[model samples]
Target: MMFGVNSKILDEIVCILSKDTNVESAYIFGSRARGDFKEYSDIDIAVFIEDPNKRNMIAVDINEINCIYKFDIVIIKESTSRELLDNIKKDGVKIYQRPF
Candidate 1:
């Protein structure tokens, strides 16, 4: 378990996210990814999906795992601005990816 987060928790989160066919990938960012979280720090997650319209659906599925921990979810599209995507890619820790 990296950054004090339980592997099982990450596994469960990945499992839940994987259920959504629209989701292409998911990453953990912010404090959690940086390994410097405080007591009340929230998990920052970035999800990449093929269909922007399905973002809300993916968020709902992510929220279902919120009981395990507080988290903020950001949905990203292929057309998302390069700057933001680059920042996330540089700092975020990838946690899930759809199987081929």
Candidate 2:
């Protein structure tokens, strides 16, 4: 229930993401975060990681997980477009972050 009470898939997604030490933080955006999801809607996730090169590793890890929902993982970085980053930051729901 990271994004909201209706998002059960998010809990499972977080478990997979949390195991990766490179992952700094994560957010959920798009229809799922807005609470207007259909049965087949993919969960859009934006992640800030320690190394951008680790993006592929993260994708493989997430894809291997047996989950009912599809996850679209986006890597957020300084080089990423300002407009797209702003939009996600504005609407995305914070779902995970590494503990200090």
What ranges in model 2 sit over 4 Å off? 1-8
Cα lDDT of model 2 by residue, 10-57, tens digit: 566788779889889988888877878777788788889988865446
User: lDDT tens digits, residues 34-84, model 1?
Assistant: 888976678788988878874366666667763557778888866678887
After superposition, candidate 1 runs with Cα above 4 Å error:
66-68, 78-83
Query: Each candidate's root-mean-square deviation in Å?
Result: 2.2, 2.5
TM-score of 2: 0.80
lDDT, candidate 1, equals 0.79
**Residue 28 deviation, candidate 1, in Å?**
0.4
Top candidate on lDDT is 1
